[model samples]
Target chain A: MKKSYITAILLVVFLLTGCWDQRLLKDVRLLLGVGIDYQKGNKVIMSSVVTRNLEKKPPELISTTGSTPRDARINLQRKLIYVPDASKNRIVMLSEALARKGSILEVLDVFYRDPRSALNAKIAIVKGKAKDFLETQSKDNPDLTAFLDRQIVTSEAATIVPDVDLQSIRTGILDPGEDIMMPYMGLNKSNVEILGGALFHGQKLTGTLTPGETTVALLLANQKNKQTTLTLPIEKGVQMTVNILQSKRKLTIQPTGQSLKVSIDLQMNAEAIEMPFGDFSDQKTVAKFNHTLSEEINKEADKVIKKLQAANCDVLGIGRQLIAHHSSYWNQIDWNKEYPKINITSSTTINLTRNGILE
Target chain B: MGTRQADKISRLELFFFILQSVIGIGILSLPYTVFSESKTDAWIAVLLAGIAITINMMINWKLSSHFPSANLFDFLPTLLGKYLSKAVSVGYIVYFLAVAYLVLLLFGDIITRWVLPRTPVLAIYFLLVSTSIYLARESLSVITRFCVIVSIFLPVLLILMLVPLNSSHFIYIFPIGQTGLEAIFKGAKETSFSIIGYELLLVIYPFVKGNHTQIRKVILLSSAFLTLFYTFLVFNCVIFFSSEELEQIPEPILYMLKSFSFRVIERIDLLFLSIWIVTVLTTFVNYLFAASIGIKQLFHQNDHRHFTLAAGFLCLLCAEFTGDRFLVQKISDFLAKASFLFVAGIPLLLLLIIYMKKLRWHGR
Candidate 1:
């Protein structure tokens, strides 16, 4: 009984001390956002926002730049009134210029190597200079990092413009025949706006897609959302706003002797939000609107497809589909050499549900 | 009856013991393995494998019912010829030892990479060995009672999965049937590896002190719980990452947990991983116990203490000689393939032999 009592006491002691490596909240500094850029003479510049202002007035933003992200982080440590741990950092912003040079791997090494770095943190590419976008303050939200994360979640836009988190970027860079895309943020005076999508061929930034072009990219990629809206032109002067209610896309790869044929089927349920010059009450007009909308969306989708084919981006992962379905044929043919010349057919079917609150 | 008295365990305790045995080190990598083969349709493979495992479990239980008070050790010789039974028992013992080694390697690798890079590998090995040996030395009832206490944290682990819910990309799992049926079927084989440890039921059958109906309920409930848990985790990884991403990551659950941040806590994966250490310890203890039990059965020893120590020492030696992570992974793959013989093929053959012998006796 005495031995059992002693054993029980020791076990309790061990359980009480639970995690010996536990760190209290007060002992660590929380980094909410990070930005990296290359300066004029072969120097690295980095800026980070610490969340010490969570209690202060309008959340203070501290800006620091150094020759490297690590160096800039050390510099921030020296300048800050309180020490902060960058391990909890949530957002990493890269300048378009720096991204063009393909140095994101270097800037991101700290996050990748550090065990405490959150792998789920959001990653974005800033248009022009990343510093300008990172420095932009929101009027209502005190914490810029939380505000930016919220915007990405709520928008759910259909573009190659995905909110590239750390896990996705890491996987995209590591995997074969797959590339990563990040949300493009541009600074307009004092505010930061999500411009479009930045496409990458491997880790290097290849090109940017405009918002209109991104819609087609998203549709082709089968990433369309329920809230996505499309605009249709019925005639030269008439226009209508259509909200996408449901969308489904299927990619089929057909073997034609020496070559492979790609076919895409797009099905959508849409409703007209505004009928500028057309009578919505007429079934015939609705049918005409549906046909015109289908044609316009298909035409827009074709232009993006042509551009992607020309660039060989494969952001739609059509090449992956071919490899998945027709592995033997895909291996026999050079995707890079044949992708530009392969025949692609885009088919669209649209069903118009209602004509807004007015109709 | 003497054997039954030595190995008796209650039905509820057996349920928790089997649950821990099935869930172990496999949960961490099953998602990656399944996804690498099947792409987005990996969840379907998990469902199929779950059904297959249930069928396997039913066969095993029925075979064990042939001798109500005996286990695999006593019944196998009657089913197969005596020499074949001994050969098969030796094969199973080696498989259990390999399981112990793989668990040690996996546990060591995770600790070195995630928690303590500077700590020497030997120290981690020692800590794990001591904890597992201490648990193995306990009686069957004691082990099950302790496991029941630890199993309470299993639900907590499930709740920790909700953190990834904040960042999941639902579209990542879209166009599910794009990978075709062949790829999905191939992936089901990988899922079967994760569900392999349920065959522990073959050894623990006599320890179960319950009505025949209750025993069936326990096994079915354990299988259902494991299936749901595995499917939930695989879905989490699938939705949390794209098909390409899931293929690249070795430990998707660890990577997914690293993404979460609460106002009070940062780097919750570290905390989550520490909890996972307990799970690993429980699994190692269970495998060690199984291996020791096999030894005792073969040698006809009443006391398992000496055999347990010897097994733990052998596992330690194997872990020490494993050298590097790459070789350890090679050994792991080898064991996964070899386990199919003991886990699937042997049991089916045993059931067939038992059924044929029963028919001949009735005809005579």
Candidate 2:
């Protein structure tokens, strides 16, 4: 009994020692964000944000350019005090020029290969150079990467371009029915401005949506949030901007033989921000305003859908909807071929709850 | 030396043991499996399975409470004849060994896929065996105490799930009840695979204190907690990934976590993976203990120390022989069905036999 107890104690001692791979915070260099740009003749420029002590009076910015992201990252190793691990990287921004060249996948692989890379890190495409967007710093937000991170979460537009992080983008690119979409950003003075959203058909950038179009896309996709602002022409000259307090979208797929009909039902609660026809508190006027607003929102939504259809970018994930709802038909129809020709009907209803502080 | 002298565990320990058992490798893959079947309504399936598991747990607890200080091995022999009971006991031992093997394989696959890609499989297997062997050799009380200590880390692991909330697309979770009942039922079967570990009650039930009422409370609390945890995780994964995207990925929870970015932390999933090691270790320890106890019962050994070492060595050998990931998964699926039989079916049979025997004796 004594020997058995001693043996058990020894076993516990041997197993309990788990300090083999213990890493201290000081020993590891934490990477916050990575920026990729296109250099001359198929080469790439990589800029990364490495977190340093704030007391050190503004940390240095490290930039490296290479033929591939690995090369650029390797080059960056010499310049950076600590080696950047993409596992914890928050954002990866691609230059429009690099995106146009179709090198986003190559750049992303560096992060993907490392087990530590986070799948949820937001991916975006800048209008000009990726460095310009990364370099842009606002007085309000000293950490530019942190500021860009919020744009993906805060945007109310369904078309505000869904935040496509590394994992989702990889999944989207790999999956047949769905495509990837990333936030389109531009440098406005020193601030990083969200220009719109870039749509990817497969791994390549197919087209771009302006902010208004992106908002319309988001609305059609049923991603309209409480903060969604809908602008409507109330009269011949008066325009009213209403804040959507709550919204719900339902898509029903009706399969009749070889063809498929898609119906979209949008329910929204909105409050008027600006009423150009002066103080109109009457039930009749509010009813008329609601009808007009619904029609206008529907029209914008239809236009965005048409543009998306033309671009062959189903960022709305309509293919996924069909698979979930009409599985049999989805299996029968060639999604890539049928998706472009599928007819869509959208019906929207807007309920005016509060008209701001004004009457 | 009689049955009444055996130590009885608290209801809380029983609850934690159940929780630790159920939340094993299955948590990692359930989101993917359920998503493939039910798509958006995967969370619904988890809730339904929770209901089923709760019922099973109640029945098992009732049967167990009938004979205090006696495990499944003790009761089965009295319920069934000696030969049948011995055969069933051997079957259960095999089932327990399979669970240990599956856990090791899962540990190896996860480490290779997420953290240490180049690490040899043998080294990982050895590490798991050594850890589990040490835990299994300890007294039941010590093992339960250690499980409680490790189970405390689960809440912290759950908090890590909140990081992905910022990146979750709520629209993906919309069109609620879209898959309907048929799809939800199919998804429930897939999700139930993860809830199978609760059967450890078969071995530990003898060690539980209190009467039927207390046992019922422990079972209900444990199943309820597991159901909620599974539901929350599946719901989070569904909201985080589109149905189309979810269908393709093998592990949606990890994939979803990959989307988050913090100023101080970049890859929260890596941190999550590290913590999940504890979760896996507890589960492995539970199964190893059960397997050793089952062996000791078969051999009529007063001391379980020798059997524990032998079982650990056998589990390690079986895991090594399982070869690669795909084969291990195939073996695990087959073993899952077997586990359902031992955990649910055998206990049910024992209850029937016990009742029939009691009725006959009363009639006489």
Candidate 3:
């Protein structure tokens, strides 16, 4: 009697779990890539790459304009046969004009607020309208979603772009003492290429960094990825390619007379991958080579720092350091006002840990 | 007496029981709640709260040791009169029921908001209360066994917390002592609510077989370890989020896990919430068992199965009705205030009364 009663109860439990939240794959369109652009009259134009069928046909590109991103998505949904789902969304693109308006938090409020939305989706700032960027497709890479995703990943690995996602970017956007820089993409002959990084002052895109300057900025900020490769002319006609295996950076904030002086010291462990004429087997030659490489890196670092200061981007988190170490001064002066006027300097030290097999 | 003797648990089981009860939904948003008062020095507040809880646990142990063979309900009538003791026992039962309802409400709220939004909150509440009744109807020994077995998932939760360390900023917790002593103490007071489950020792003391000194050692060691664990969790959340950012996230731990995606699993927060369901079950079962024991003592019954069912139904009905978010918050605040009286206020008063009675007998 007891065993049968237990069996009856188990059967009831197994049979009674109704499918209230079950979502079928056939009933929804997978929105893999999304782009949001700023329009006049406080409107947003949202473009999306949605996959209707997985096997044969390519994904479709649709665009709509509404008061908010969610509103725009709803407007786009009305045109689709099936409901659009963003749970598997891989990338979110924003136009440079939209990012410049400095209401990024408002644009992204839906992603953070919705539990079903993808939080780790890669975010990028396109040089032109995001709607046009999403619509651009090359013959070789027909799927712009996967192509742009892989491009951002590879650029991050090469230390040409900072690794950022919807979730990780929140800290920089929300924190008052820091700023964020995202992968900047541009259209080149109907193909999208990662130009560099779009530097932000708070939520606004104030300036852009070139590819080489981005690497230097990331290295100085101690946010480098897998590898750091640089090709510099050591002499009048001698071009050498160096691969940095390791890097360390230190920033010291000191009060100097009327303003604060911030000094950055960067150390790099480098390997000479391509050198036309160099004998690292000798101690004196290695010392001279290190000196010349260090000098060249220092000059480039100076340019990146100046550009960052001019844009008022504290990606290095100088304001964070001051808030942590010197709160009294942090409370007294406004960081946005003082960031541009502060005296900032950087120096580099390079140690050639390895040379090519021939050397 | 016979069943109580047959249901004796070892020291390790008791330790697991207390540990599982103390760690619950409170840990999910503890860092955010404490930070509201303490700022960057929230971890220090957690440390201070841990010390305070350990001291309170010792006081409870001292009272229980005074009557080693009797539980709280069994000994209360000797201190207070028969009617007053009965009122006190009913009040204790009501408090446990309220806590169990709070647990159910929170569990249902999180499950609906995070994982299964389309599913009804009533379904989640029913599922939790039914399972709680199944184990709570049995003796304390069975509940402790279940707790010890599921303790394996505690380490998994800890390791999942460590994954967010890659993106964390340790400098966010700098200038630690700047929040000052006053704010830190207020933070400690706020923390005391989250770690409120340890007071179950009042009902658990008689069912464990150990001498006073040994039991004291076990209690001290277990409570101290819990304090350290709570401090570690709070410290991790503080370092992971800035003071400004922490304000925006209600459940910082879940939000932190939601941001990270592994190669295999895409949404880690969902996985965390599923495992957290187990801990929530243990916590709810603890309260249900305590309330059932109170009912059995009141009616002079030999079995507690029917009482367990009754209490479970009561909590489920209460949780279903208090669906409004503001009402749930108001209820939890009331429970936190009432917990001080039942967990510490009455026990200390009884101990003082016992001391005074002994002095009067010596004078006679």
Candidate 4:
């Protein structure tokens, strides 16, 4: 009888403390990706894709219109069987129209304010309608999130796109000397491909960066893109592909009176993938080829700098370095106005380690 | 010799008893507070504060040694009259209640803001107070043993602070002495409250199984460790954020971790808060333990356990009175000012008075 009484007490103890926060696995819909697009009359159209299974075929899609992203999600709650959980979100896409307007900090702040919201979710700006990119299917992977994630990872490997998550992007947003540049994704027929990057002056998207220009910016920032390939036109008809095995950059800044003299030193280890017109094995040809490749890299870098200056983009974080190393000079001038007029130059030194199996 | 129950606290338990007593909630906002005044030189402030606390520990050691068998309550009447001693004891009891209440309010606020938004502040306060009372019912030896077990987990806590270095910048600590000496000292003054918990030694000295010299060693060692621990945290925070960015977020350590997440854990700040809530609760337990002992000594009460309930009631009442952050800050400022009398002012004054009385005896 006493043993039964002890058992009863133990059972009561277990029954007394209920799990108030208990969430069942089956009762929640996990949002994988969210696409934000602006409509006429300043309306925001939020489109979300909820992942149902690992097979990735028949997931749920919902689109709702509201003044804010939260409002849009709240509106979407009416149509879902379970609560929409964005904590598992892998990516967020902004339409070119919304990005061009550039006042997207408000839309992005919702993700930051909530502790449960995904801060590391990869963000991309569509070169066209974000809904189109979301609607399009990838031939290789049926899962759009997995497909887009792979594309982003490859782009970062090639140094064609920056490897910044939402948290890293927050630094550029809050920081005055630096600005954010995100991957520019676009729909190519049915497949959404990563084009290049969209440059931003704070939260407002300034302009687009070409694929080649993206490589120049990445190289200038010393962001390692080991597998990056540079294709050059040598002697009119002969084209050569130089696969960069490793790369590094050194940025030097000198404030002279009212102007800033900036020089970028790019050092790279590369291999000639296709040297069809050159001699099989000649030292003189290799010397000339190295000089030619260095000149090509510098030329591309100069063009990228010009475009960056025109857009007033401190994408290389040069302005931040100035603030850190030379605060007096940084305080003397307005970065936005002075950045476009700042004199900048670049020089590249490439050591061609190998010329492929033919060599 | 100490009572057999008092003698149960070993040398290691003695070290952790002081260590756990000192390292409470002060660490949460220590970096931000020091940085606000001294900027990048906040780590210097942490080191200086450690020195000041050690000096206080020396004075406390001198007094406790002067009266070996007696705790602060038993000897205060010998130094001052019975009425004055009673007044001082009541003041300490009130101080402990106020401090515990403040910690309860802070615990409730952090949990509400970061962990459980739906739970009422009263519920959180009740939970903390109830746990502290249950633990406070135990003897000092039992408490020290429990504290030793808790202090063993300090390394794990320190390791969690290191995870945010992946995205941190080392350049923030450069030009380290840019702030003037006055600013750094003023910053040290800002850290007085975080280092306030060491005063528990004045009450628990006889309870510890050690000679006076050994007591000083434990106190100094705890002070040094706390200094290094706080300095390490402050220095890491200074490195984690830019000089200007550190000012924007009040809790640099939490903010730094908020931006970082591991593969298995998303929102590492929440994980940190879960562990940190225990530290906050530890602070609550420390004060309640101190206050109950004060009650037992003052009234010659047979059992101190009853006073734990009374203390918890008073703490709950104080916590409930604090309805908003503005009021809490005001109360915290008042307590920070009042802490000087309890920690340093009274101990040093007692030492001076006793030394003067000794000189008179020698002259006679």
Report the lDDT of model 2 for residue B351. Answer: 86
Worst 10 residues of 2 chain A by lDDT: A52-61
Ranking by lDDT: 3, 4, 1, 2
Clash pairs for candidate 4: A102-A204
TM-score, cand. 2: 0.73
TM-scores of the candidates in the order shown: 0.73, 0.73, 0.97, 0.90
Question: CAPRI band of model 4?
Answer: acceptable
Q: Provide the RMSD of all predictions against the true structure, rounded to 1 decimal.
A: 6.2, 6.0, 1.8, 3.4
lDDT of 2 by residue, A1-359 (tens): 97798578666655544444444556555667778888888788888776664344343356798889889888888876666565556678888877776656677787766656666677888888777666655234555554466776566233355645677687667555566667888877766678887877767787898887887677767655546776778788888888878888887878899998888888888878777565657888888888888898888878877777776787777887766556777779888777779898888888898987778
The positional error of residue A321 in candidate 4, measured at the CA in angstroms, is 2.3
Please list all clashing residue pairs in model 1, or write none if there are none: A29-A84
Q: Candidate 4's residue-wise lDDT over A1-359, tens digit each? A: 95588457556644533343445557778888888999988888988887664444756567889889898888888878688888777788899899878787778877867756777788889977776667665233445554455677788888889877776776676667777788888877676677888888878888878877887788887775647887876557787888888887889999989889999999998888887887638888877888887887788889988888887788887877787788778888999888889999998887788888887
What tens-digit string does per-residue lDDT give for candidate 3 at B255-290?
889888899999898888878899999999999999
Task: Give the winner by TM-score.
Answer: 3
Q: Which ten residues in a row have the lowest lDDT in candidate 1 chain B?
A: B166-175
Can you tell me the CAPRI class of model 3?
medium
lDDT (tens digit, per residue) of candidate 1 on B125-235? 767876788789777778888778889889878998888886675555656677788998888887886677777788888878977778999889988998889989999
Chain B TM-score, all predictions listed: 0.96, 0.96, 0.98, 0.96
Each prediction's number of clashing residue pairs: 1, 11, 0, 1
In the order shown, the chain A TM-scores of the predictions are: 0.87, 0.85, 0.94, 0.91
